[model samples]
Target chain A: MKTKVYNKQAFIALQSILVKEITRYFRIWIQTLLPPAITMTLYFVIFGQLIGSRVGLMEGVSYMEYITPGIIMMSVITNSYSNVASSFYSAKFQRNVEELLVAPVPTLFILLGYVFGGVSRGMITGVIVTLVASQFVELQINNWAIVCFVVILTSMMFATAGLVNAVFAKSFDDISIIPTFVLTPLTYLGGVFYSIKMLPEFWQNVSLANPVLYMVNAFRYGFLGVSDIPIENAIALIIFFIVGLFSIAYYLLAKGIGIRS
Target chain B: MKNKAIAISDLKKTYSNGFEALKGISFEVAEGDFIALLGPNGAGKSTTIGVICSLVNKTAGSVSVFGHSIDQHLEAAKRCIGLVPQEFNFSQFETCQQIVVNQAGYYGVPRHIALERAEVVLKQLDLWDKKDSQARMLSGGMKRRLMIARALMHEPKILILDEPTAGVDIEIRRTMWTFLRELNEQGTTIVLTTHYLEEAEQLCRNIAIIDHGTIVENTSMKDLLSRLDIETFILDVDSVPNELPKLENVEYRIRDESTIEIDVPKEKALNQVFESLTEKGIRVLSMRNKSNRLEELFVQLTERAQVVDREQKNEN
Candidate 1:
């Protein structure tokens, strides 16, 4: 069929995917975004108000503000990670990914599709929870650009990571195991509720091994202009992981790792 | 490269598990060719399409689409080949039009051009009415048509369909086939993998039968049927007389508990048999060739192959 052509349809397709991704989480907001906000509120009540009364604060900021950045970062981390993981996994499960895979779409655009899907959900939940945290404590957004940068970049990073997870994952259990056995513990001990300075010198040194620590502290710096870890390293490492994860995702997809077979 | 729209040269695929799926398969589909890739399940049909589309990485051999080596110029090669996978695989959340337009984008068609192509392709496939419908909301046959529409969005030179009408009803399938033939007439080389041999017999001018991960037979349709030399015919009469009548080049066998199989050779005419039957006034029952020769030939070859395989297994 010598059909008439619409040059702007690429924008339409991208718009369609973004709309679909947004709608997917919105339709299931009860499960995707709302729960994390609730979980963080609980953390605010128990960990910040109750635990801070006894543990005190660090870096001259109240424990509430200090932990707020980490909690918000944690939300971005989990939401982005799980959104891509489950969404892509579901596509694999339902055989829908095959549709896009066979198309002439570039590997990057396809990766961007699923990765940005995770970004949208992560940021949506991150913002909502940030609002919720404001009801409890005095908040400061020292650098809005950095705050948005880290949120979006971290979201992109974890979303790509989640896409890789979806590629290798075989079943539903495979999808959940990472969040439980790997992500949850990493986020919690990642200094989400306490400063690394609270840890003994040896443990504090060991805490550097956690990638989430850098992300959380970097995000905290974005909020209050302070960080236990070097902010430059935080920014560089995020870019590093984003590039790294995006490449791995591109490889797996181009290789048709799980979907084609 | 020589007016060949699609050429698969010694294509082989061996999985990481060491199970060979395509054992050096070789064939060429000329421009505007309608070739049927015929096989039973687990016979490497999907593998062939997957390899051509660059979805299933090949362990050996090479494939070229419209003279561009997929290995050397993947994007250019892939741009010429559009594959409609057998399974329902589009994102359920996407409307039918979105799926088709997105596929166009992969080929570097801009969004405006993609939508225009998407609209025409969708309408041609009888899916324009369902353009805005979510893929999951459509019926099975409509979804299958949607897939075909999506594949055509880029106006690919070579279109590969994996069982394009496997689950659809006969009427709808026929409708799809008609549209496909029109598309094929417009100079798109169509490669189809199908289980329905009768459909293969009707639509494909050339046929390739794959068995046990190998191209067992590949030939033009006329040549393939002429190769089916076992001739069959039917005699119609009131009933068979107790006394039997012998006719040249005709072999008989009882069928349906009362009917009989009559096989005739090329040298003999039905009139001779009719005269012989009338000479005895033997009441004959209704008769016709059991079916086209391909079915019997396919059965004969595969059965013989299986028997040989079994004997070899026993010896091993």
Candidate 2:
């Protein structure tokens, strides 16, 4: 049996790919990162500061603080998701991806490279939104570890989701469809503004089915020490979702599902 | 001398849609060997390269490089190979140096070493001056050279080029050919796939002609040429020939009443024909031999597949 030595090259490949992904969006930072920050800022101003004043407290916390973490998580998820999805799809569209595909790097590393790139951008945008939200909601972190962990996990989840989308996407419109039709709706109704406690019993069960509800409330709990579901359960659910997403992503990549060949 | 840098045996690929892209390809390329994969479109040329590069999955087969099995040692096999693709398929937003160096990193070279190799390859390919320019800003020829430089940065033992100079300008094509020949002399086993038969004739020592997803012919260039059996020699006499050259194993046609077109079995003694013309006190003119090379072989193989297709359709 022959043994292969340690592959330091995989890490370098990962870093370079991450840089390429980062610069791709940063090169057009005004369009890619800045617009989202500005848009999220407006949401905080209009919905949280301006609108929350009239609505008052839901779940006993100020509307401004309740929506802050959810909004930050949302931006992180979407940005990370969109970054990898569009970048990978663009590589496919331009036929440039053949270079990497033809290289000897492990498929897992390639996936990580693109995912980290998206995740990095997502985190950067999320931090920016969080800072802006701090001014409006007077944010607090009940558990710094949970806040950071959820942010990173959510970034990974969405990054993998984005790549899967890119692989299945045949054209430009294919990527945006899920984001517009599916992602936006689930998010808007995922307890971003109001808690599930306000809902009747039947509707409350239905809301529990939305995974984003767990993620948002879990993230919100990290900030204000309150959540719709148990904090410990939310952590378990996020980890469960991460492993499930990671396995599916790995299997899809290894099988070259929509991509291999 | 190096025990066959690349040894491929019984490689096959069947698409999910039931199309057999490759029907058990088998070949061996020695160190410093320049082999040309010649065929028309969809003849499994790309599929063969894809399998060796580990991009295209094979339905059934085996391949080895540097005595290492591909399945068990993909990274090791890949580390020994470099692929230069046909299309200008790179991150266009990055500069030329970035593309080459980034590719080197994928192979696990340290950053400084990768940079040094990048500089050397770029200079060799006449791309040093354009190092700062992004791929989108460069001309088609420069972009092709950039791709070549990127592939060379890692210094792999086997270099596979898929139509590296397909649509470039004449000057650039000639430059690329010269650079490749230099690399070949330095002991890199080059596997080139191209539409240009003349390139194969000029560069490759061994040739494989594939058609309809199967290997039609594989042999030394000398053997393939010899087997062709026909050569047209153009002899320009100082004066118009009143009659054609009366010689055995040859045919002639008067051209402008000065040049005579001579067709003969390449093995026939052309010296006898020459002596007869000299004995006739005919002033010798310039002569040109039209050896039927890979061009004829490629045309024959591609056309034969087409005929087969036609017959199959007719029977159906």
Candidate 3:
């Protein structure tokens, strides 16, 4: 019969969900945190050591250094997307999502709790990939603020996107389809390997349409002080996507779209 | 004036598939009252609970808890409710203690308080020893108790249990009944939907029988039972009468050599039948109601609803 103030209740609820999510993946660190590290290590070994030795500089830097930001960005995007999509979908599938739905927590806090959890995983994986990259290439951060902003925003953007995916997802298979068909292609073609300028005019325009391109290039600018696009434009697009996706997520949650029915 | 723990009016639910699961139903539960919301499967009991808890969108209706409207004061309304859903809805991998504590945290209980409440409820539910075990590892009965323990963590004023004892063994079910009685005695308003009529008859002071998305009867247990026109009793006899006893306003049949079934209408007196049998030198050893009184009323009401439904369909 005791009721806390609204803000306090929301804070506690959000913290609980975040803690639950963190504990879940942390308990299975071998599966959640370890795989990305090993995968990024392989990427550094093959792309940075073996392939960069054969290929010359493309973006005014060695192929290894040029792809480092893209690789790290790739891991962050995938980790953020997969973390929310899989985790939320699992909650739905297992029906434990009802716990939050029945509680006094607002929909906004519930959405944020899941997103922050994804962001945490994304940040952790990004750091792991960075460490793995530093083993092969000399690393230097050009703009600390931009780097932090880009990585966090990029993670939030994808985590929000993952939440949207999870809201519409009907099954476990639905959760994976977007990451595989849509996300993988977008990340790879987002110019993780080669500069978009090297492509033909029509392909360059197509690459420009890929939002991941802006994120990767912006992140590249943060690390190497070089980018294929303007930093301001990249930041603008990231903000735009985050706002758009978050609005959609909030609306879906408010409507009780998938989680409620 | 005493406050109502829950007040629902004109509740209706139309699924996305156009199934009108709940027509329009209105009911209220008084504070500190233990009530049974009895209905067959698909009778809208779960949907009603779902709407109160905001798990399902209501197509039309209003539900308020302790005078807090769900729409205008959702958090306040939700703060007063604890829902134990019919299914095992907790994360299977979570430890028993973690499940309860996390649920408390969702209600804004601090980590320390949540942890303390978790231990207390888990121990009270006899799940403390299994606090560290994964939820999936517990037996079905223990899992059910875990749900109760989780729901009780925040200690809401009103607890709605949706078939909490389904699939549980009789012994555990009775123990849960006792626990719930204790909780209700301490002033927790309990509204339980149960398929077991005996549990309802034994535990709840009030009853509501819902049929075909409508409430056919909502009254105190005494009033509901008083509405029964006839009750059958099974009597153990020391000696079998070759001919069944003849009594006015009563039907009699022999079940076997030692047992007899007697259908007693409200107009008939039990002592009259005993006196008539005693004059004939037949002594009754024992007697028991052939069925729980609530079960008999529930069947009659539901069947009557079906008949009315069929008649309406034919007219249409």
Candidate 4:
């Protein structure tokens, strides 16, 4: 009976955190949801329509179709990462994270609450970007299960990474530095617009070292049934990252890093 | 004997910067007791509160709430405590109702129950009309009341408020006192820290004075006030006497044409002062304590503690 009551309370705490996070982004829709849709639409219009006409049939499919999954995955990664990082950091700046810190709620619940909130935003943005992509080209799903699993897992991994970043962040500038210097460069080089197979031998090996590359290839494989890396390898790597990042994020929270005195 | 609501044993905290905020202070609060944990600035009152709430890591020693050790049973211990921190810590963008309800949720209250509790607390704090307004839009006093409301939503057994009325106006502070008094009367254990010595004296049955990172005095309010050797009283007179009346063991100073301050020792009766004033033909219109009784003892105890600390330092 005691464990049951504890579980029930834990569930409510998780729900509260998740609802607050979702309401925050939805309350400022123009900033959180709209920007990603507009940016992805621009990518679809320029890279898939204007530039694709000149370079076609690189992956045995239309250029617009090949880049669709990558564009959608890109939205998921960036949105997931930014959603948790900005929300958690703002909570710290406002000194409101003490709400959870002082509560009876388990640390795991708090960590999962923020992670799932980020995943929710990421998945929602992914859907919005997909809808925009459909306006420019028709999307075909080669495997629905794989597509769902990869996108959700990739979002969870990035969200947990965002949490770790928020844990260490001391100022607004600290939160932005990681997204600008690390996320942006890695996303651009992660084969969002072109295939890694098109690169030289040495560069292909180096591209393999980028974690985002595996996420993009796995998502693309789910949609187009083609990938530079094996489907098994991509799924394994994504799971590996989710576990690793989740552990780090949980450890930081339990230790009260940057949040507690 | 009343059960202990909180037991902190040899609690110590040293910040990462090598500053020792708590130097093994030990104290216990009984169930249903309204106690004041008084301390000067940086005297470890806030750090001690932080450690009990698990917001600050204690370097050594132990804290237990309602028999649950903080280290071994943190969640169980936390469930008993509702903390209204010294600062406004809620999100500025969140509505008053949302803030209160969410705090309940964090403590595992169901949404419907939390919503109902939010209404009750908001109304109790006189924040019902501003329930939908964002937190930042509230005035300083209203924000503090909102924090109190939020802390009370879960109905915890122990409510710990750190400087809950630091900058509040007297009227609002009195109203809050009434509310907190009602809470204590209903059997809730309240541990409060406030710089307002009068507030502490009025509301708390017990008092603990900390200074130089140590517990210098811990006694009941009645007993502690009895330790005051002398009390200064300000008297308003109809006219000043040309020659002040001299009394045994009493000193007097004229402030203005119609006012005089008198230091009355514990053995002297106030009626004796009144009789002497009548004999002197100095018509006393009003009289009040020049400083709060607790304030006087607090200063004496803290000052003595400082002297002891200096002596130890010299010895070292």
Poorest stretch of ten by lDDT in candidate 1 chain B: B252-261
Q: Chain A TM-scores, one per candidate?
A: 0.93, 0.94, 0.96, 0.97
Q: For each candidate, what is the lDDT?
A: 0.83, 0.84, 0.92, 0.93
If scored against the real structure, what TM-score would every candidate get?
0.90, 0.91, 0.96, 0.97
Q: Model 3's lDDT to the true fold?
A: 0.92
Candidate 1: list runs displaced more than 4 Å: A1-20, A45-59, B233-237, B256-258, B280-286, B304-316
Ten residues in a row with the worst lDDT in model 3 chain B? B239-248
In candidate 1, what are the lDDT values of residues B70-89, reduced to their tens digit?
88877668778878888888
Top DockQ prediction, candidate number: 4
Better of 1 and 2 by TM-score: 2
lDDT, model 2, position B214: 75
- The interface RMSD for candidate 1 is 3.4
Best by lDDT: 4
- lDDT (Cα, tens digit) per residue for candidate 4, span A170-253: 899998999999998898899988899899999999999999999999999889999999999999999999999999998999
User: Please, what are the lDDT tens digits per residue for candidate 3 over residues B235-256?
Assistant: 9999888876678988888899
Off by over 4 Å in 2: A1-6, B233-247, B253-262, B267-292, B301-316
Sort the candidates on TM-score, descending order.
4, 3, 2, 1
> For model 3, how does the per-residue alpha-carbon lDDT over A97-180 read when each residue is reduced to its tens digit?
999988988888999999999999999999998988888999988999999999999999999999999989998899899989
Predicted candidate 2 versus true structure: per-residue lDDT over B29-112, tens digit per residue: 788899999888888999988888877888888888887777888878888888988777888888898888888877777789
DockQ ranking from best candidate downward? 4, 3, 2, 1
- Report the TM-score for the A-chain of model 2: 0.94
